[model samples]
Target: MSDKGLFISFEGIDGSGKSTQARLLADHLRDAGRDVILTREPGGSPGAEEIRALVLQGDPDRWSAETEILLFTAARRDHLERTIRPALAAGKVVICDRFADSTRMYQGLSRGDLRGVVDRLHDLMIGVEPDLTILIDMDPTEGLSRALSRKGAEERFEDFGEDLQKAMRAGFLALADEFADRFRVVDGARAVDDVASDVRAVADGFLPKRRV
Candidate 1:
């Protein structure tokens, strides 16, 4: 936890139901009377949202791996300054849809062998890690199928297709191992509620007791 607040992030390959689960967890915590701020990366603040459209839309090759790294870092800086840090300072529970780990996988491993670049930039610009990161693990084939069905405009990463999704799945799992202390892997292959139930259970173990 940072600044007396609980910071939680959810991650998985695209269409792995992480977004839905993040929202559900936010709702659950709110019902339990915790102050919660649910937001997403690359778009939590206005400035970052603009950058999000640039990076998340258009062709998959819209930007080179090196260039995407800079753009994402900039967006994250603004997001941290304007959204995440302030929420934490207020002692609210911050549930993010995706965070730096997504960049570590997408731009770091997926596009090229530039993980060092991503890490260096992150350490320099935004140095905060979530208190807990919930990784919704799913089968790549199933995840890709679900992602394509969305037909959303922010499908640039999804447009990379199944092989990338498979790679992302493996990379994310490796990341969980690397950051094992804070990463919790939940099976996303199950029904949404079942997955959420597991996620809630995992989160409860980390959450502090409610204030009197």
Candidate 2:
């Protein structure tokens, strides 16, 4: 792949500060004069946004594991076709807040089948993988507490309870271990600025030489 552009993704449990760091990195890159596009999965494009509403705020009891996975992929397909691919083709650095990994974690928690879902999605859609994935690792209990304290509402899968979140965390960690080269697990317990700095360092490693 060319250094002209890069696709970097931030992944983590809710309240792990992935969005915060993603925005910070985008700002840093923009200040340094890099063309960057900061976006999120499940809602990047118009079609995806509608799907996101359904998936996130709609009736959870009406959703099955298979149906949920399909909805996610449908949104992802729209996002890629409408936003991600175009930005990358324009040679802009693309920073996605959440991507396929989130689906693997969430759906894996709901379904207990990680390998099949991830592999099938990779095969069917999601042609380009992130150049680097920053997995903001945090303890599920702490992360959940922070999330609930901050947001004050549990939507859809987040309402699945604490044990599910813990299992999802374990799934993410296991993926990090298996794909060491592609994954960077950052300790998310640090101060916000500290975590952002760590994320910036990881991003800079993939970026071309430039003073930030």
For each candidate, give its TM-score against the true structure: 0.99, 0.92
> Mind sharing the TM-score for model 2?
0.92
Each prediction's RMSD to truth: 0.7, 2.1
Residues 1-212, candidate 2, lDDT per residue (tens digit)? 32357889999887777888899999999997899999997789999998988888745576877778889899999999899888888889999999888887788554667558766876778666788899998888888877777753336666676887788788899888977878998999999999988888888888877655
The candidate scoring highest on lDDT is 1
**In TM-score terms, which candidate is top?**
1
Clashing pairs in 2: none
List the candidate 2 regions with Cα displacement exceeding 4 Å. Answer: 2-4, 152-154, 210-212
Per-residue lDDT of model 1, residues 1-212, tens digit only = 78889999999999899999999999999999999999998889999999999999999888999999999999999999999999999999999999999999999999889999999999999999999999999999999999999998999998899999999999999999999999999999999999999999999999998768
